[model samples]
Target: MQKILCFTALFASLVLTFLNTQSEAAIGANEIIRFSWRANTEPVTGYKLYYAEGAVTGPPFNGKNALQGNSPINVGNVTQTSLSGLDVHQNYSFALTAFNECSESAFTDVIIVYSVTISIHGNGTVGTYTSFWTENHGNETIHFFPSDGHFVSNVVVNGTSFGSTESITLNDVTEKKVIDVYFSPEKTVERDTSFPLWSGSFNENADVQGSIFIASDGVYVSQTTDTYTTNISKVSDGFCPKSGWNANYHLIQFIDVDNDGWLDIAGFGYNGLVVAYGIDGTNYHTAVNVISGNFGYNNGWRIDHHIREISDIDGDGVNDVWGFGYNGLVVAYGIDGTNYHKPKLALNSFGYNDGWEITDYRRFLDVDNDGYLDISGWKDGVNYVSLFNSANETYDNIVEWW
Candidate 1:
């Protein structure tokens, strides 16, 4: 059952003076925001919902304000529509435009909406979310467990550290709360006669779309780790299906585009495409090529070094992705509004060009508590490290081993 929050009377009329129109309120939730408008005298096909982060004043629709989150609520001549995939506590300005058979009407006056629903985000192998009980504005408890081969690294709420507690009771949920629990995969590596414990903090960054991408022998996409055994598919079904996705799905990354409470999954496969699966909080979803084999000439960009949730490089509220390629090309994967893992060149030490002396491991630290991921790596036989200055976007070699 969907929780309705937009209208106080189940149909609060929004007074729109354009040709004298009124609309019902919007439903705000962890994953969706519903909006409704009264029917018009003229015949129309559907309504288009446009939203942006802040308030916008326009004569021609966004005269000075930049808008985002594009959707044409196509419910077939219905007055009601819900905009899904939204984050908690974010302010969104929405505007409605009617579309007929051929053309779209000018944007109507904007409506301001806020997401008061609490969101719980869990990362790592087969992530899942379960709301104990909807109190709307009271104490809430969040619990998590690592998979068979994984362990919980840390739990955070609204950017505050919540430590290693598997379950946490949020004291007051007056505002929309975002709880992110990160997990790291652990494996025992044989050092010689014995196997010592080796654990890493990977997949620590956050998402609200709650999507998990699993790439072991094959790629699996699921909303929770629990149904992974059941929801796993090879053809991608509705998500992006590639010719060889059934084969070399090596690395998987979870990202939340559009700031929605759910996370989307990015797959680094041997087929040379960074395919991403955007979960719609349900089974229906699609995976697209973030980078295809035709992209970057298929550089054979195998990911090295277990990626940790390094400190947020910028103050954008999301952790920046730092990836080291097999070719010594350091790349950063960013998400578009649609949640695609688009890689940007962060740095290139050209380790692959230098006799293919591979750089195996890398780590990130602020050192001085700055908002940048300082680079540290073990290449060839060198234990060198670099410092990141976010202001200049350059890495100063603090230590270089020859």
Candidate 2:
């Protein structure tokens, strides 16, 4: 009969420590992490090391998973050994085990060797200007904001030029990196027009050349002949007979309200607004109030408020109405059929009373091509995008664009 004998190899603990004053002479430019552990109480032949790059949730560790080098690294019977050829930018998880001629003991608790440093040298800042370190495979966005009269000349990433983009995102970071931003004095360049400018009769091409004008009583469209003779026709009464329409302070724009492939008239007056569909250049339906009551001049809406053309601000495919108040109040209404849905306050008060002229410098578009439209503008020496929630501070996501 063969006798079956059982022996146990138990490890009290396994520890990982970073060697402070260790020299990397044999490993060239690679780094080292020193590991120490209490030897098993029972006699064992040797210890094997197992490791991987990322966090190991709970593991029945395998030796072939080592990232830097081979795992189950035979460290003989030593209780401590220094691992070399490690990349400092990578996070590592390690476990230890003891093996004998009969069987190997269970793996010890996982020990993590994870942390990397990021060095930033620039005139601007990123993410609140704090946090100099990030976990492996983390993400971060860098925003460039040059001082007044200065512009970002170039953004250097690990000694490579990253173009003149206002912002950039570092995705899945896996290396120790250096970012340097340089600035230069702002300069203006003058250039002539790319195409020649000319004037001719508006009726030369009947379908292409026409002008729409507004009067105190109604709206009109005009066409001019070769002899400079102008002829006009009344288009719609959506503006004159319209409720709360202001003769001196009103505006109108051509828009396709119902998606019917026909042009419509959207009128904005002193106290009220309307969207009149079925405009065929000569007649249109009676203007219906898009908004219930008048937006008083002193309250939220006014004659000078910027009323933008219909756009899919919410990315719903259907065009919506957008209005920017002079006091930096932004209002948008989603469209349902020919009626505007409930109003949503996109921005409460950003740059309140700051004399922002959206018609001249501000535009709403997808500056980052993220599908949703963003409030973008240029003022003074800076070009800015309100990418996120822009409450009252207008300096968010701002960059110098010459």
Candidate 3:
């Protein structure tokens, strides 16, 4: 009985060795590869996966010849499957062989995976400014389309588009007016992400054009044709030099500074000069020194800059100038028939810093036919204009009047 048992064990060992060799030889050049695979019959428990750049057969698939790495990856003792990190974009050849205590199986079919791309363009008017929006998907149909007007009406979701009825007409028509376009997505996505996705504004003659992205603040304005393209972030600080000027001597305001009924130009540039030029019905006269020695940076102790807000502040039927300077000071100067007043700083017992960073100021005509002169300023960080009651010398945060 002992002799019989030894012979049977020896025979089983020889069969196992043969099966192992046969399994290694079964893998072919092309095979559908997975990081892992299921064990078939034969008590199989694991897999050995191999890959190469081009089609090559046989073993020792290592060194630079291997697209992955130098070592032959052994996927040890996995019950049902395995995992691999391979480039999905490239065309790769792979093979999977099953493994167990006694034998292994051949590789499966070769399968491929690839990627896709998409493009977008704007249709309708090219340079003509309109609020309309249209996005073309790969298909001939329009995927994202919204009509022109208020930005609140245009909505978009995970690439899907919806339209709303809310809209605003272009009011306060001027030489240059900015029309802001906003995108208000649904609640499921995100609130802060809703922003001004598009913009269009008018030029000096009301010619329309597409606008670039500002600071995501949803505020945009047009530049006079003569003005240089300025970064949107600096627009509120006042008119920066459009062209042909120095840094300290920037053009502050373009108005009828001389009250000649026609619009004249007045600017406070470097060297404390509030220069004025007459629009002689056609061309500008050589700038006359109006308030040359009275404005701008003083000897580092303090710099009293020109008022960015320029309008008729006093209601004396003449346009007055108003500006803010360093150290929380607001200056107001009247344009007399000949010259401007030495700018008077608005005074408070506690002094000028009442959270007002004045950008531009204007006298509000009693549009409702009220008798008092109303004053207002374009302020910093707030969308609504700041209106002041000049008669009572009080400030009110009013939105409807603006």
Candidate 4:
């Protein structure tokens, strides 16, 4: 025998805003909705929250008609509870009930609503006049504003290139969306379509075969034809997926790692991770994590470390990564196709620490005219050279240059 736990009063309302306009304002799919009510006058063990798809009208608002298998969840003896991970594509009706060991109370009035989440990326922000979470299908005006000295370059919605405008009104939003707003400097508001596009610290300055690859802030890469007049910018998802590669303090190097005549991008993250992006014709794809970490050399390799040089350390005709920084720390690895072999500890330390900081003087060349590339640099006012032995793959012959 089950007895109905009677409550003096029960109320349920959306934590955000309850809009009753011509167009129902829904909630964001990724948002958490909290429901709170007045405590029952009688003694009760706890409360259970039940939700089902579609607007449940009339009758008992109970878990029997809930969408998911795990409908009514026991939220313990609390007057308030929060729930998240709701599907925005569907309408939902929520019902609450109080229960004791022997009896359960009748569910409260049903609350029907809908939801969807919007994400923003790049150098601008998004502003929706209403709450990201809404109810009825209605037009949403999303405003995009750029930072100082920057203008909206492109507005990409769900990967489709939308017009570059100050704002975009999404007519009748019904699903999850991602908005990427790329910004360009005010000076370059109008694109440069001249011959021999300007190359500086911003774009790629490498020659891939007869063509040159250009990069915009490391986020985009464009390729130029032999004539240097026609510039084609292509966006691919193969550039530095992991390793936290940023353009602020990171260094980018373009080289033919596979020796297939096509130049690839090898970016060194500030945290000692190497990310490589291969180029095919005008597109850059197949991003691979070349070096996971510094391999226990130094914590990080900054821009001044000069570790972006790609050379053949063992003279295998294949380019390798040679990096040196403060504390005489060195990190070297030989490239094998898109992957790299075990790191070759060419030189761990050069006697004194903090020596490489005296000057930006470091080189990975055949200093003594050896077949293999040697390491030569200044360590605390003293010039030293470490000759590489190709046979054993080590740097042994250490000498001082007075």
By lDDT, the candidates rank as 2, 4, 1, 3
- Kindly list the per-residue Cα lDDT of model 1 for residues 1-402, writing each as its tens digit: 543222112112333211101111122232444456777546665665566653444423321122223443345667776544444345456666666655666666666543332333333332232222122334544456666666554456677554344567755333345566665444322111111111222134433112233333333333233333332233243212333333222444444433444444445555433534333332224566544442222345433332322124544555444444443435444444443354555555534443334335666656555766576667667766677766686777447744
Query: What ranges in model 2 sit over 4 Å off?
Result: 1-210, 222-232, 241-244, 294-299, 305-308, 326-329, 349-355, 358-360, 388-402
TM-score of 3: 0.30
TM-score of each: 0.37, 0.40, 0.30, 0.41
- Scored by lDDT, model 2 comes in at 0.54
In order, what is each prediction's RMSD in angstroms? 18.6, 21.9, 25.2, 17.1
| Tens digit of per-residue lDDT, candidate 3, span 1-402 | 222111111111100000011111122222222343444434444555555543344443431333334334566655333223333223334455655555555544422221111111221111111111111111222222322421232222223222221233332221122222223222111111222223322123322232322222212222222222331211121122233233344434445565655334454555344544433222345555565444544311122232454667556776655544543334446657446777554533112244443333433445344555444344443333334466676544445344
Task: Please tell me which predicted candidate would have the highest lDDT against the true structure.
Answer: 2
Write the residue-wise lDDT of candidate 4 on 1-402 in tens digits.
Answer: 556465544443323233321111233433455677777777788887887765775444443422223577788998887666555445567777777776677767666655433444445555544333334546767676777765565566676544345677766544445556665544321222221133322213332223333333223332323333232333333323233434445566666666655556665654444544444433456455666666222445566443456666566777666665444535555656566765544576552354455245667778767566777777567777777777786777568866
- lDDT score, candidate 2, position 102: 80
Of the two candidates 3 and 4, the one with more favorable lDDT, higher being better, is 4
- lDDT for each residue of candidate 2 in 1-402, tens digit (9 for 90 to 100): 444334654555887665423211122233556778988887777888887765674464443423345776878898998776655445567888887778778878777554332333334433322122223435656566666765554456666454344556776544445566654445332211221111221222222234444454555443322211134444565465333455345555666666654556676655445777743333457777775443333235655545445656665667776666654534445567476765545664333365566444767767767565677777775676666433552223434444
> What is the Cα-based TM-score of model 4?
0.41
Winner of 2 and 3 under TM-score: 2
| TM-score between model 2 and native | 0.40
lDDT (C-alpha) at residue 202 in model 4: 21
Runs in model 3 lying further than 4 Å from the true structure: 1-245, 279-281, 292-294, 299-307, 327-329, 335-337, 349-355, 358-370, 374-402
Give me the displacement of residue 74 in model 2, in angstroms.
Answer: 99
